[model samples]
Each structure stands twice: as structure tokens, then as C-alpha cells.
Target: MSASSSVAAGRGAPRQASGALWQALPFLGIFAAALILPMVSNDYWTLIATRAAIYWVLVSALNLVVGFAGQLAIGWVAMLTLGAYTTSVLVAGNVMPPVPVFPALGVAALVGGVFGFIVGLPALRLRTFYFAMTTLGFATIVTQVALAWQGVTGGGIGIVGPVLPAPFDTIFGFYLFCLGLAAFCTWISANAAHSRFGRSLVAIRDAEVAAESSGISKPRLLGAVFLFAGAMAGIAGGLFATLQSYISPEAFTFDLSVLFFIAILIGGRGSILGPFIATIVLTWLPEFAAPLVAWSTFLYAALLLAIVLLVPGGIAALLDFRSRRRIEADRTIVPRPELLPEILGGRKASEAITLKDIVLSFGGVRAVDGLDLTIEPGAVHGLIGPNGSGKTTTLNVICGFYRPETGSVTVDGEPLPAAAPQTRAASGIARTFQTPKLIGEASVLQNVMVGGAIRGRGSFVESLLALPRHRQDEAMLRHDALLALRCVGLGALADVRADRLQHSELRFLEIARALMLRPRFLLLDEPAAGLSAEEIRSLGGLIRAISRQGTGVLLVEHHADLIFEICDQVTVLNLGRELAAGTPAEIRAHPEVVSAYLGS
Candidate 1:
């Protein structure tokens, strides 16, 4: 074989950074202050820092949805109420006034999470401004209920919560508790940002429909993130309420929700330290400048807006780029000695995917009717059809993006349920879109990393703990992702954001993303739709290499000549029906195929 190309070096290419601090010294100072509160300060300072830490978690928690998941939530204050009441009801044994601490904190986390789930239900049926309105409306109703139902919430004044348990009563004890919880929330949020679960959130944000096709359940994943965020926010609220010995609707407001949005936009959306940095500045600057506090708040707002408009990547992109680059550069990459016999990589001619008698209906229209097809292992099967002949519809049904009205989709001889798209993907199927769909808001590497979510030593726990094995596994995956990007001629642009890629490069990037799945079979829909002749030639070579390696590739292409040159077998479709299926030579000579091509 001609020298096999290895993109090991390309995978480690350096990335340009926005030059912001990756790790914040200021946050480190705050962290140290939190742990040593009683030793250095009196009761008042300790309480202030404690409350600040709690607010820090609030912003971080909200970021999961508004920042990372790309959903705007205006009812976040409701979480505070849910948390305070849940904790009060559980630990405050004095049923008369309800005033206990420890158990309440734990229960608050749980109850708040449950309530968040309930509140998030509307997210399933709503999106964009409608979802925002729903959340805002819910928050308004919840606040009204809290105020009107004074019997439980102590009326407009709110409830006077009890002190925590024995150890927690002391300033040091309470300070340590607040700090630890804040740290825990930060660590978990950061890990989720890097883990498979986190990538799923980004995927959902980028494109919910595409995310489903890639095997991520939209509702379940969205609920999980919301629940997780709710729990964290509840902890913060519970702690803040306990520190002050009071809770009320007056304390939480819509302004707080807007502030979190501004903070994430300024500090960076995905970084753990972003919220900490933004919260500290927002919380302290006004306090220190009490004389002109309102004006100070206005200034902060202006600063946040300027950052969003100018340095859109936020502080995390500016600060962490070099650190991530240095880390990526220090790893070694080894090309597999032999490509494996899997869908995304490693294959030799074999039968892996087969489609028989597939039919797709969109209400009144028949997109695909009685489509019979078989894709063998190590074969490049080209699907050719005239306008509206249903090539994409066939791919959609097979991938579970659309369920066929009357047909079965089988992978390796097993039929998958229509609703289970992720199951279909997990069954070893991967695909690229005609229009590239990726999480553009995320880092270039993270966008592809979403597909490299196979489980191994790098468990979610390992990533959270930053363990040795997890780091190693993460390094390996990053290397492989870069290599895959280069395989499709996108090596130089590995670190460039997908949204910023040129037209031709976008096509390659889409294929690069699918390759991250390590699929057993792949479906390429119009991979050459917008490519020039030169790009198309290179793309043809790639299909051949993929076929030679034993990967079964089903390609849907509009360019008839390119299909003939690249595909080993060709299937022609007309009016949603398979007109002919044969080798390229046979297809070129068929009378019926000619008639379809030239008009019968």
C-alpha cells in the first residue's frame, strides 16, 4: 500500500487564543478567602463572602441553560424560592415557623431539582422567545403564589429560617460549608462541559433535530441538564438563606436573571471560572462603591455588552486557548497499525447495513416509496435520483431523523424501533449532512468531541475528578479527533470554529465530525453539493479509501459524473422508486437508466 497518511501531528496543531486569562487569580483569591473566613474576618465579612459564593453558583447553574444549552430562561428566581422552602420544610423541625438547616439543604437540592424538571416540561413544547415567555410567566406565577400563600411563606416578609445544626452554627463552620458547596458546583459544571453529557447539551443547542439524528434524545438530555442546574442553584439559595436566617421573594428577582445572562456573556459561557469572575466583580464593585452603586451597576452592564459585541468568545476563549494548546501539543499520537473493522474506522469488504422495501410519507406526500436497497461492507453505494426523488428522505428514515410510515430499518440484521435515534447511532451507524450542522458556539475541538463519546477509562467521574486515566483518555480522543479532521483535509483548520469555516471546508468538517463516531456504516448525503471540481476529486479519493478499509458507505450525490467515478455500485431512483441497481459500468450501459437521465 502507498504510505498510509497519519494525521497525528496535525491533531496537535496549535490554536489561536483571545489572550484572556484561562485560570483566574482573582477567583483563586476568593476561594482561599472562603476557606479561611473565620480565621481572618469577623461575622459580617464572612457572611458577605458566603453570600457571594452562593450567588456565584446561581450564575453558574443558570449558564447550563441560557449559556451552554442556548435557551433563555427568565424565571430563574423561582429556583431560589423552591430551594429555600424545600430546605425549610425538611430541616426546620419547628413546624410552627419551620427553622432547621442540614437536612433542609440536602432536601432543597433534591426538591429544587424536581421542581426544575417540572418547570422544564414546557421546554419540550416551546423554544426561543416562546420558551423564554413560558419561563418568565411561570416565574411570575410562582412569585405571586409565594406572596399570596403567606400561611407557608410568611407573607411578603418571607420566612425567618432557623440556624443550621451544631457544627454549622459557628462562622467558620458555615463559611466552610458554603465554600465547599460552591467549589463542588464549579467542579461538576466544568466536568459536564467536558464530558459526553456536556457535549450532548452543546449538540442540542446547535441543532436539536441534528442532535436527535446523531443519537441524543432531545427531551431526556434537556431534562437532565435542567435538573442538574436546578440542584446546583438550590444549594446556593439554601446556603444564602441559611446565612441570613431569612428567605423571601423580594430577595430574588428578574434583574438577577438578566445579570447572570450579562455575566456569562462577559466572562465566557463554558468556562467554570467565568461565573466566579463575573459574580465577584458584579457583587463587590457595587458594595465597595456604595456611594455610586446604581451608576456602578450601569457601568458593569455597559462593559458586559461591549464584551459580547467585541470579544464574543468571552474570557474563557481568550484565557484557555493557549493552555489547551500547550496540553494538546504535549501528547503523542500513533496511527492504528491496521484500520479496524468498524463503521467509522477500520473495515474490509463485508455486509454491514441492508435496507429493503423502505417507504417514507410526509402527510400527503410520498418522499420515498418502496425503496429497496442494500449496502455491503467495504462498498461505496451511490444513491442517484432526480429532483425530489427522495435520496435525503431515505437517509433520514434510516438514521431515525424521520420514521418511515411503512418499512423497517435494519442494521447488521437487527430492526430498530422508529423512535430510537440514539439507539440506531449506537448500533454503529454515522452520517454527514449536506449542510454542515455542528455546535458552532463551542470550541472547534469540542464540536467534534461530541461524536467521540464512546465510553472507556475516561468516565464522567474521572473527568470530574481530573484523574490520571481520564486525562490520558481525553488526550487520546483529542488526538484521534484531530487525526480524523485531517483525514478529510481539514487538519489545518482543526482549531478553527466550524461556523467560521469556508464553504468547501465546511463540507469536509461535516464528514470529519461523523468520523468521530467510529461508525460501522456511514451515510453521506450530498457530500459534493457545493464543492468545486478539484474538491470533488479529492472527495472521491476519500470515498475509495473508506471503502478499501472495509467501511460500507452509502452516498447520496446530485453530481452524476462524480457518483459514477467514485462509487463501486450505483442505485438510481425515479419518482421515489428504485429504477436500477448495479455496478457503475452496468449503470452506464443501462437503457432505462439512460432514459431517466436523458428524459424518456
Candidate 2:
């Protein structure tokens, strides 16, 4: 297990490991059973298995976004719809002036991914219901367009899709074809859930704001999820069209979206086995419901309601439940004494984070009023005044979370934006919040993977397709993320959940994440405010090493004792302004500093 892909949890994190594989066994058995399914050999059974497998692929694709990433997607069927319709049009013998069928299917999937990317771009700006509403609108719009377009989409007439020429005609051949696609997709989705890219999705899903501040680009990560999910939906759709030997606008409707959600929830969100269970049960549901067909609706509704009300987190939670000790054993959080010094060395800095003519205001408050200052790169710079000294406000302005009213923030001539947070981060400015803003449910490795993506390549499409280049790039990022955790002395805690870490560890982990952006400069809000004396000294040293490496680091620490002991230079703020800037010794002796410290 390289650092980036480890499973994390321990101590405070409740037991989850024992249940994971125990639930997975059924899938193993099912796969084994499926091998014998083809042996049943009869056309009737083969066709049923084929249908189940096709839906299985659909469920798996939805799982990537809806389950693992925890994003509610109702429009998943849209991509599949695009794939089926595109394939129908291209192979219709009249559209596109003629093209081979297989290439058409491939083209259909690619086109679906492209369209899905367009839909997801808007998701970056919205969240929760707003996000869901945006996707739903997209689904509704596409359906209306398909319904209205008579010439290309065949209007309400639908489409008579092309068939596989010779080798793919029989049920056996078709079953094998669908099985091949389902198997490939299942492997892709499952492996991804355990890999760096998948971890990034989980991080974004868990908390977009924290992920962005930690150097993970929210737009790109979300887009990657959308593209991968879309490709899977497209692949499944094409197969469904082939299987039915026909398709229509009605085939991809609002209810299909609901079905996708139900499968993930019932199967277990974030579990590899969840989709399989959901798919099997759903594929056979109508037949099973046939016996009680009249009362079945009532019974089904009651059962689904019970499942939702009782096991809210999903079936994966129930199936993967295990004894506490076993769960603790799986996550390797520990003392990790060997890594302490390297972490300590990272803080001992010599330069300051400087803001010249910095200004910010809300209405007329002038929260930060023309702040002029420099924080020595490796020094513990303190911004202190009475209440609302604009300490936190200053941090926000420098990191680009808020646009300053005026003045430029320059770090060795690398100017920061007055507005855009992302652009500032790309220029090597990274920061943390007073609150530990981490994705609580995701593993430590996963959260850090989001941080590490700054160095990765390939847009959403390439990664979903598992192009050789993207795969290689992901592997490299994983290696780098692990190395970063190790540098901060959190290697053993790689698999631990961020929410489960000791408060100090969470603080360290945040800095570790910031480092993963490979920033030439770091802006730490307050790393020592919550730590003990030993931890404070450790923070001091860490700042120094980061400075020594030529990466400027600016720290705002409240603990003047720690600050004075470690900072080569210090700048103090009073009444929303820079009181003074100088070497630690000079400031400590200055009359104004003496008054500020003594409260004279």
C-alpha cells in the first residue's frame, strides 16, 4: 500500500473494516455463480442474465458519483440516453452520411461524456439542492429536445438501432458482449474507488470549500467525476439499445433517474458490493413483485421506506459493520515518533508574508484598513490587536477567498489576485482555517489525494477512459501524496479518517495537504493556537524548514511566546493596522511592542 491508497480509520473511528469484505464475499460468489450462468445455455435464461448485467453496468456507473462521491444525481440516465440515440442516428444508414457501427458506439460514448462535462461545469458553482436542481433541469431539457426534434431523433417515432453484423447476433454472443462490458466497467469503478482519483471525488463530495482551500481544484475534480460517470452511463445505454433492438425518448425519463438513486442507496453507498446487490434485486424486482402485483406496490413502498428510515447511511454500512477492535486494527494511526523532526524542521522560517497597502471593507467597516506589513518567510508572525483585529480577515484576503478593496499582495514579485482564490493557489499560495475544515467521512489518504491533484494531468475524459497517460500520472501523484504525509510525520495515519485525528494531527494534516500543492509560498492562519507546548515548538521548526527550501511561509500565531522564540522577524497589528515590523528581538524591545504586550 503506497501512502496515497491506504484505507484509514482508527481510535475514534467506529469499526467498519470487518463488514467490508464479509459483504464483498456475496459478490465473489455471484461472479462465480455467473460463470455457470452461461452454462445454463438456454436462450431464455441467457437473455434475462443479459438484461440484469446491462442494468448492473448502469448501477455501477451511478455508484461512482452517487455512492462513492456522495453526490445526488437524478439525471444520470441522460448520458445513457445520449449514447443510445447517438448510436441509433449514426447507424441509421441515413445519418452522418454513413459510418461503421462499432465506431459509432465509441463515438456515442465520447459524445455523451462531452455533453456530461458541459452539465457538470455548472455543478461546480452550485451545491446540494441547487446542484441537484441544475442537473434535473439538464435532464428535462434534453428530453424535451429529443421529443421535439423530428428529423434527427425520429421525433416520437423513436429509433430502430442497428444490430451487430454477424458474430454478435445470437443470445450467447450478445450475452458475452454485455458481460464483457459490465465486467470491464465493474473493475474500473471498483479500482477507482480505491485509487487516488476516486479519493479526490470522495473529498470533493464530502466538502467542497475545505477541499478548495487545501489546494484541490473543485471544478476539475467534479468534472472528472461527471465525465467518468457519463462514460459508464453511455456504455450501458448503448448496450441497452442493442439489447432491446430499439430505443425511444421515453426510455430515458425522470423515473430512470430515481431508479439509479434507489439502487445505490439500497446497495450501500461507498461500497463495492452495493451496486451489485442493488442491480440484482432491482432487475428481478418486477417478476418477484408479479405474485403480489396488486398489493406489491404497497409492500414495495413500505419496504423501501423501512430501509430508508432505518439504515439511512445505506446497506453498505450495515453489511460492512464489524467489531470495534477489528476496525481499529485496519486503520494504522499511531505515535509515529520517527517522523517528528522532519515535520518540526518545516516551520523554522526567516521571511514574512508581506501585504502592501492591503485594504478590505464591508459596506464601510474597512475590516482591513490599508495594512502594510511583511512576515519573514519562516517566522511566526503575529497579528494582534483587541477584538476583531482583522486577524482572520487578513488571512482570507491574502488567500484570495475575498477580494481586497485595494493594494497588491506580493511574495517575491509573484502577485496575488484581489479576487480569485484558485488563481492565488496555483501561484503557490496555500492556507488553512481556524476550524479544521476536512471531509469527515473520507479517509485521510483520500483527502490528501485531492490536495495532490494540482500536479496531476488529463482532464475528466481521459481519466475516465483509463488512458495510459492519465493512469501513469495518477500513480505518480499517489507516490507524491504519500511522501508529503510522511514528511509531516503522518504516514502511519494515512488511512485514518480526517475527523478521527487528534486535533493537533488534524492541524498538521492540513499543513501537510498544503505542502502537497508544492507551493512556493504558504499562508498558515494559526497552526499553534490549539496545540500543546511541545506541538507549538514543533510547528515553529516546521516553518523554518519550509523557508530553508526557498518556499516562503507566513504564519499568524496568537501564542506570542512561541512566535517570539522561533520568528527571525515579527510584525504586529493593532487596531486594524500594522503597528510595527522588525526582527523578533527588535520588536520585543521596542516601546510600542512593550506597550502592546503589557497592555499599557
For all candidates in order, the CA lDDT equals 0.71, 0.69
lDDT (tens digit, per residue) of candidate 2 on 363-412: 87778888887754433455554457777888888777888878878766
The count of residue-pair clashes in candidate 1 stands at 15
lDDT of 2 at 112: 76
Off by over 4 Å in 2: 1-29, 41-45, 68-70, 94-99, 150-154, 268-271, 291-309, 319-353, 457-483, 544-550, 585-600
Q: Indicate which candidate wins on TM-score.
A: 1
The 10-residue segment with the lowest total lDDT in model 1: 328-337
TM-score of each: 0.84, 0.83
Candidate 1, residues 318-398: lDDT per residue as tens digits?
Answer: 765543443232222122313322224433333467677888877787888898888887789999978788888888788
True-vs-predicted CA distance for residue 568, candidate 1, Å: 2.0
The residue-level lDDT of candidate 1 at 2 comes to 18
Report the error of model 2 at residue 197, Å: 3.1
RMSD of each predicted structure: 5.3, 5.4
